[model samples]
Target: MNHQERTHAVLSASGAHRWLLCTPSARLEEQFPDTTSDAAREGTLAHELAEMKLRHYFQTKEFGKRKYNAEVKKLKTEELWQDEMDGYTEIYKDYIKTLALSFPAEPYSAIEKRVDFSQYVPDGFGTADCILLSGNTLHVIDLKYGKGVPVSAEENPQMMLYALGAYQAYSFLYDIRSIHLVIIQPRLDSISEWECPLGELLEFAEYVKDRAKLAINGEGEFCPGEKQCRFCRAKAQCRARAEENVKLAFNPDKGKLPPLISNKEMGKYLAYGEDVAKWLSDLKEHALKECLAGREVPGWKAVEGRGSRDWTDMDAAFEVLKEKGIAEEILYEKKALTLAQVEKTIGKKDFAEMVGGMVVKNPGKPTLVKESDKREAITNKITAEKAFQEEQ
Candidate 1:
């Protein structure tokens, strides 16, 4: 084992202590040929530790109460402890079943190869989470317990880097034609799979080699932006800090006439907004190209974007309650509840019976509503619906 692998072993062992463990170096960051900042390091570490704790909590039911109580104390809030526990337990059971069928190996939490990508030298190097030689293929599964959009495994630089390493380590012994890169993200409800062709994989290895040479020779500037900056630890000391103001301008809250906005401040905001828009457009184009560069899966299209939430139909809800002899006055006065809270509030059996045959209408689709648009849309919808009902 090299220095990186040794460090990972130490940290993984220490991670059993829950909160006291040190962070493991990200394989991608190590292979990137750029120095990562402390802030970025801290953020990544915190995310990993939270994932570890969540995994531990779900794996063993005996410590459920203790873990829940610890979370309550740490967060200093009594909100959603039981609900979270219930959801975690359900998901954990499902995942355990998935592992049993997919892996069937003895220890569920075993680390196969750590930073073992030395074979594809002068190209790229990465630490693989686990490599299971099942049947004819090698399954390289990377666990990303994060809540962000699942990392696409197809043409992923990190996965390719690991494949390069695997080829060097085991190509002589095994006739490996394909590298299976699987991202298991339980939190985001996403599972992504990518396969690498040997030829293309080698091409990417060359690209990595060229990039590393540029980075080492200081041939290119480290151009940081919102996407990368979000996780960058060196932001405070980074020269890019001055550029943040420009990025924040295009943020969701830009045009809102804040209670206080001086003319000078407004000018600065507008200037920053313009810069951010251009930067984001360029970033998106680059990412899209990188994603589709490798082999394509048959009948598999790029994922579609999901809409966000808007207002619920309170008036419709009231009408439904009225039909059930629940007075609007009483209903309006009572606290509103989320779907899950309602389940717990009335007990599962009663709640299920109450909504058994009822069809729950969704709120209208989400739109980018301006303040002016919000009032007009709500008024128009309510008025139109009322008028049509009256005519009927």
Candidate 2:
């Protein structure tokens, strides 16, 4: 997709979950405009870095042209264009080459290929980070720059649509047998994969075609869910989302308690606190917009958020720390090591062999969480001692 076409009317792969569930959201979103965000700018830099690394790997670009500058024109210096991004993009390039190595000849590889999924969704198109067309399989790799949310490969409509687009574009030349959808989240240090046979993928395409028809026409229902509303532009003012959150809170005017909850009831609404948190955040943002427009709400007024004092130059302040005879270690907090980063650095087998023994388990702090959380509950010391005595 070119610069102009990038913002056209299309059921974007990224927003597939939103339109598929809350079909009217696509139309409603047209009223709102896009805003440039820090996260979005960071993502742009990451994608540019990825493109440069991939292009240089294939020997298409000149040596000096491949270098990346953190400071873009009229943009603040990016802190993300360091060893982390470089290392991850190397891993991405290696993954593509490793898959292509198995082929008899040098397999065809494309970076940032503009894929058209219009066969399934109307005017649907997005750039695939990398596509490796090897023997009997098509590998579609997507590089996600965000670290806040971990994306999965299982039943991901966005990646699935990309697969359809890639298959349609290359099927004429290659006898493709399967489509491999992969999501490489570098910041999370995760590589998730999903494979679908040609037949099964086509079935999903048909489902998408029907959904796209309804979504484009605004004829579908406004069924709200966590997945659908997470990235919706109109989420702050969505009627359906508000209604869903209201259902969780009971009638306050009625008598105090609603009696005890059963096992089934507790399991269902255990994780709903996050939804309430989202509602509060969205409501405040909505009210702030009205306040800024000279339409103040009843009880709330616009107020500046808290800010911290900062040195004119942080490096100069750090130099002052050296003059005071403060140890560098005392001045700087060492970044903690994550399990994912460790495992990624060394292969799983070597990690288990070399450094796994040094690992230690610490008791996590007591937390009130949803029953759906995978972590097993850790009982309090009193309860544990009582149960042990009873058993004796």
Candidate 3:
């Protein structure tokens, strides 16, 4: 499968849910720089790996065994490559093969196919990880690499957009009457699929068209909630989000309440519990950044949180321990307690008397805390070392 470099649109299909729900976020997010996380890098690597294997499976002639082996070797050499990724990619490949077999005949396959849905979403386009078109069916498969959340294909705007794009691109060649949207999240051991008639898909496109116009023009309401805001770049400082969470946390307008909270109200509160916590965390992170940038964030300041310790030289440090008559077994067991855990178990006094001389402490990383926090306020000159092997 040939890979296509993904170029994100202002209203990209991947962020369809966010933009569709919080229509103004697309413009709001443009204020912040795009950033990638370690997890996202790993997911990209996983996609590369999965694409290589699937290309080999579907286009065996063009992507032969020797070429496939070379690609696999190159992918395995990636810094973020994990041993478990091999199994996960294999799971994805096997699922695709199984899906193809279920079709009446050999399906036409495309890997990392770029699809344009500009008709519905202005300048919208996204890469379909895999597309299998056969007879009357159009299948759009998406490989989700993250285990943190299990994405479903049922009415998933991202999957729907991809399916729409595939249909627009292939319906002329194939008598496509039905559409299948698939989410293969192997890490979560889930394979969710949603199928619909071509007519229903067209209706979905119309719905998207209405929202896309609002999103592209930045004319829609700033509806702030969890799902839509999860990946929004502007989430941390969005006034709408702050206001919504504030209301959720303290619905003072409810005035007087019953002695006991009603079950219905409790359920509603519980539903937004994670969202409220996440918003507060994001608020603190935003304020911390402002303070670090030399801006005054009224009641908060940055200070040293906690630092991890590590050995400058593991072998030399262990040698010192051996000289101190400490056996190797006591010092290792999947490398035993994380310093603090060990100290707590052995009693801090005993730990200090026994092994304290062998270890050195490092100051914690810069952190944001209340102005009244007892810890002394310090500049952002923090550092870190290997957690269990700090140099003495």
Candidate 4:
């Protein structure tokens, strides 16, 4: 009925596969706020791009189009879906070229193998990104494009889950001696890789399964911190998080204080348990606005009023020059002086002091400045000059 609700519905319907692939639970929507914001749109776009690149790679291979067409037929028949697929393919192609140049034969972009993690499923289901085969070694690369910090490839729950899924799905086809989890965050200047024995990965998978079970069963504790709460969409609804925000907003003694000898000493000494930072910030903003409006503060003096400057009266200067027997053309021409030239004429120290705190003001109300004003001023001056010439 409302904008947010409608947005959530559209996102949910369109991003069901993405949600399932990444978080695999309704609770993920509660946990990660960044995952729900406009930033999530970028992630969706990245995923679509990655998929398109993969499809294009397949198309280039023999019978790739037939295989892709068959898969598309199996998936859905929506025009919107097809358009998205095409868009993703183009994005992926560009992304892959960049990756290739950067990594150089490091097998950038998509890995087209599926993984099963049925044994590691603690509560709900989970899936891996894709499994990579490099010579005899097996590597798993996960792409994380969101602003959220990339999950460390080493000892990461998400990476471990993906490893489990990969091993489950692909072990039958390969010798599968070892598993390496690599997290690539192109947005961040980071690439982390971790290796584990086949046995170790399986053990970690089991550990993750236990954790997932606890989380699903409502036994998991909230990890409350600034970093965790930054993009959490469910923050307003979360009791623990709401309390944290209230404490942060109201806690006077919590933040860093300046040296106690100044006004800061009074602030710390009178540490009312409530946060006064917001009030102080608001007061400063209001004070600034009043000062700009030329309103006088009780204890503050108007040290200087602002005004504008203009060129000297050119006609008066020209008349003085003419009386001094100088040519009108030589005297009335425009000229610009450098700082050094000005300093020679007026001593540097005096000039510096004179100009140090100069404040320029608007000439007048902007509305008074019109084309007609200039014309009228010039016309009146011309009329007076003609009458004076007649008298002469």
lDDT of each: 0.50, 0.76, 0.86, 0.51
Candidate 1 regions off by >4 Å?
1-112, 119-127, 216-218, 236-337, 340-392
Off by over 4 Å in 3: 1-5, 253-256, 324-392
- TM-score of every candidate: 0.45, 0.75, 0.82, 0.44
- The clash count of every prediction, one per candidate, is 3, 0, 7, 7
Best by lDDT: 3
1 or 2, which is superior by lDDT?
A: 2
lDDT-wise, the better of 3 and 4 is: 3
Tell me the tens digit of each residue's lDDT in model 1 across 1-392.
12112243211211212111111122223433444454434334333333334445434574476775574364334232233333433453355346546755532232335445433332234456555454445556665544655567777666666666666777777777767777666556667787766777788767655554444333454554444444433333343433554447535464557698787776666555653665555545434544477535454434557979854997887788899999768875656788867777765556668984674757876554323221345433567668899999
Candidate structures ordered by lDDT, highest first: 3, 2, 4, 1
Model 2: per-residue lDDT, tens digit, 1-392? 12223454448887887887777788888878867677766676667666766666664554234243322221224454444555656666677667677788887888878889898898898777888887888888988878876677877988888888899899999999988889988777778898888898899999889999999987788987777877777888888888878876653335565588677666666656567678779889889999999996999999888989978998899889989998778878979669867776665557779888988878777887655444587764678678899999
TM-score, ranked from best to worst: 3, 2, 1, 4
Global local distance difference test of model 3: 0.86
lDDT of 3 by residue, 1-392 (tens): 33324569999988998999999999999999998888988999899989888888888898999999998898888888776777778888998999899888898999999899999999999899999988898999999999886677888899889998898898778999999899998877888888999899899899999999999998889999888988899999999998899887887435676788787776666776768999988888988999889999988899888999998999999999999999999888874569867765665557789999998878888875435344689764444544334553
What is the TM-score (0 to 1) of candidate 1? 0.45
